[model samples]
Target: MKLFRIVHPLNGVQRLLLTVWVGAMWAIGYVAAPVLFAAIESRMQAGAIAGTLFSIVSWIGLLCGGLILLVQWRARHRGLSRVALSCIIAMLIITGVGQFGLQPMMADIKAQFPAGVEMSGELRSRFGALHGISSTLFLIASMLGALAVWRSAPTDL
Candidate 1:
């Protein structure tokens, strides 16, 4: 009973964190990135801007996800569903793969080319493939975030 009293307030905090994290993911991936690509004249410039935004959002996810996991861990006995926890973990892993893995390879490929010179043939194909994988991973993470938020709700729990 005492623990419930302490953990109860954290429920609101957890919900807020989830909302912020998932909302950022949707806003950045679906809205802002596309707008940058369409509105900006230079593909390289647009990509750079979009990449920075993605990096920022990824860090936001890491922070929010870490805090949410800590809160869930603390309140584990309070009927928190394992599904929600699993979703968060999966989202984190996706974020990691996108950030640390695919992004670096793509960046390296980009670095190989000169400032205005575009990649050709094999390099272009490889970059395109990596970007596609990154985008797919981002989509999966966004969906998982939505699932986590839904499953972690007090009503659902």
Candidate 2:
């Protein structure tokens, strides 16, 4: 919407903030995906994936997040400009779908997990550890974005 550009402002600070937001989303997605995948892996209630879907999907999501940020930077550089940023923003809109879109789909997956299968406490904890590391990476990406913005970019024509 027009309100986002108006409110967020396309200055250095905003650009950095935008990058942080995107990065965090990716990190969290990776972390969460594994947790969900492990849970699904444990249940193995007939229809579960033979390999890891969430794991790959999560990695893809992370990659996409970085790519999208690059797209934003390119847009700022007057390459794609506002149109590029808008398209990237539209892509980010998919990121927001997680709060709603993903959870519902995952609920069905959770239900598919059979009760009797035993998943070790350590495995669950390890997944948590991965989540933590991935989350830290996410934060690091945000910090990098802020640094990139604050350091000054070449705006000369």
Candidate 3:
């Protein structure tokens, strides 16, 4: 009983939660964010500063997720040495960077809604579609990372 007590109750929960979160974020970032951030125009995909704000929020979210990964590591590593600390850390860093620093560099990504910039509904829809594709890829990567950790768990290690 004492030995079991030593184990984290959320032994599997952390990775599961991570998987779910990644999927959810991918959907939000790729689907919801663009829809909400960009404005509809008749011909071009034009958006306001809201898109930029979304990017900033995204960076903050990634940074926060990295921090959560640290907590997950400390909580789950007692008997699971095969799931190395360094690998998890590295994954967190990579994801954090991509989420935080990469999305803001789009060619037409404006800082805010310009007073009179013309945009099209199709463009915003296209942007959302592309964002969805990228986020789906990101979600896949996160799932693979979680699966790697799970598969690496050794009975003795």
Best by TM-score: 1
TM-score of each: 0.89, 0.35, 0.44
The count of residue-pair clashes in candidate 3 stands at 7
Deviation (Å) of 29 in candidate 2: 5.7
Name the regions of candidate 2 deviating beyond 4 angstroms: 1-10, 25-80, 114-154
In candidate 1, which residue pairs get closer than 3 Å at backbone N, Cα or C atoms, i.e. clash?
Answer: none
Please give the RMSD of candidate 2 to the true structure: 11.8
Q: Find the 10 residues in a row with the least total lDDT in model 3.
A: 41-50
Whichever of 1 and 3 has more lDDT, that candidate is 1
Model 3 ranges off by over 4 Å: 1-7, 29-64, 79-91, 107-109, 112-157
lDDT of 2: 0.45
lDDT for each candidate structure: 0.86, 0.45, 0.50
For model 1, residues 86-129, the per-residue Cα lDDT tens digits are 88889888888888899899999999999978789999999999
The superposed Cα distance between candidate 3 and the true structure at residue 107, in angstroms, equals: 8.9
In candidate 3, which residue pairs get closer than 3 Å at backbone N, Cα or C atoms, i.e. clash?
43-120, 44-119, 44-120, 48-112, 48-113, 49-112, 49-113
In terms of lDDT, the best-performing candidate is 1
